[model samples]
Target: MVNIANYNDLVVGDRVIEAGNSENFQTGDWRSLIPVIDIDKCIDCFTCWIYCPDDCIIIKDDMIVGIKATHCKGCGICAKACPKKAITMTPEE
Candidate 1:
């Protein structure tokens, strides 16, 4: 799918990009889960920041919050490091 949840614009203008040679768009192919931040529960622990294997976690003002969902391999390290039980592992729908 073309990320229907986020971007709904399907308009395609003329471009030099070619089709058919691109990777599979099949549903059976497995994909990784990307994290979204819940700022309410974030306590600036920075534990999730240090534990991220891919260094995907985003930090501001010393707070450990969201991970780079696109790059995240769905590793549970961020969820484990969240001392406040803020991070939750969710399947990509």
Candidate 2:
């Protein structure tokens, strides 16, 4: 027989028993918006990279390069974080 814990048996606090496993899921298809970058307005300050919850910002040589669309949920967090207004969120096609 399998033993399963009921809701009444669960712990009350937010606890992490394991390391983050978000990389195993591709959540981009759930997004309704997509981010577009204007390279000319980008200063490579990494603001987008810093604010991305999904780690979807791509970086190369200490510079912001592009977005990793596969894991990006398009939450618009990166676009809102850009100080230069370099990133824009557009409706997904």
Candidate 3:
């Protein structure tokens, strides 16, 4: 993932284009926390997938499978947004 701190340095022309562009940056490595999914608790509501700023949530057959740790920035929005409370943010070791 592109360094978020450098975003402010970019000009108007330097912006992501197309869908899923964040994949190119591999930003998850920069995160200090990681999101863990409790599959048993998950209702497959997709709340985390919809709220992920980095689009790291993986979905299959309309079911929320897991998170892409390589692209996740450890933002706790997923955990907070989950109505089932299936997601939790933990500090990386």
Candidate 4:
């Protein structure tokens, strides 16, 4: 009989995450969502920028807000921070 533990991908050194390599993650699992902003209703109060834990919301000149998805963890803070309901949390396609 073959050992069950023998057939796994384990790569040590330089490639490990600082959060550490987790041994139990399946494919297609979601860790976050991306926040989308509606420019029409946004007043650019900078609430989202201040509230974002990842500092991903970039507001420019009180006119537009940009969501940096690469740096964003999508904790929905921007949605909550928006006083005008201008932000929504949507999953990446």
Candidate 5:
């Protein structure tokens, strides 16, 4: 349904063009793995939030709810930084 023939036509020299805004993009599909949060084991220390490169960890009422999978790249930084081992990286289904 989409056309790729025009892709070459859109290219500019060297520099890459800034496409549409990232908010409209769902990059989670690019990940082969996903982070899973066990809120029960979470100590509410905010460590995960501090280490999450994508800042996809959801926080509310001073508590971490979960991750926003849409922007998460499954880099595992949050999981590694969690002292409570509350976050785990799992294969995406």
Candidate 6:
């Protein structure tokens, strides 16, 4: 059987004790909402990418492509930063 740590066994704070180990943790599973990008409405201004805390915005050749759902925590910062309203937060189903 797999061993899982309960709340009492977890660390006290949200600190990264080791450097260059953030990739080992995947935080997307707990998000209640997800960001959706409308490529048609995107102006390629990179506004969403600038404000995204998780770096979930995907850019290609100077164009906003999509969101990286695997690492996105649905903070809604990207949606609010989109000047063209190209990004929207939707409930995760």
lDDT of 3 by residue, 4-91 (tens): 6665666578565578665577887789988899999999878788888888889998888888988888879999999988888888
lDDT of 5: 0.85
Per-candidate Cα lDDT values, in order, are 0.63, 0.87, 0.84, 0.70, 0.85, 0.84
Answer with 3 or 5, whichever has the higher lDDT. 5
Candidate with the larger lDDT of 1 and 2? 2
Measured against the true structure, the TM-scores of the candidates, in listed sequence, are: 0.56, 0.75, 0.74, 0.62, 0.74, 0.77
Q: Model 6, poorest ten-residue lDDT window? A: 9-18
The global Cα lDDT (0 to 1) of model 1 is 0.63
Q: Relative to the unseen true structure, what is the Cα RMSD of model 6? A: 4.3
Query: Taking the tens digit of each residue's C-alpha lDDT, what string does model 1 give over 10-37?
Result: 3356343657632233322233654555
What TM-score does prediction 6 earn? Answer: 0.77
Cα RMSD to the true fold for all candidates: 10.0, 5.6, 5.7, 6.8, 3.6, 4.3
Candidate 2: stretches off by over 4 Å: 1-21
In the range 1-93, model 2's lDDT, one tens digit per residue, is 788768676556755455776677799898888999999999999888888988999989988888899999989999898999999999976
Candidate 4 lDDT tens digits, 1-93: 965543246446435555633423332233367788998888877888888876667766665658765566667877987899999888787
- For 17-77, candidate 6 gives per-residue lDDT tens digits of 6687766678888699998988899889998888988888888888888888878888899
lDDT for 40 in candidate 2 is: 95
| Residue pairs with backbone atoms closer than 3 Å in model 5 (clashes) | none
Residue range 28-63, candidate 5, lDDT tens digits:
777777889998999899998988877799999999
Please give the RMSD of candidate 3 to the true structure: 5.7
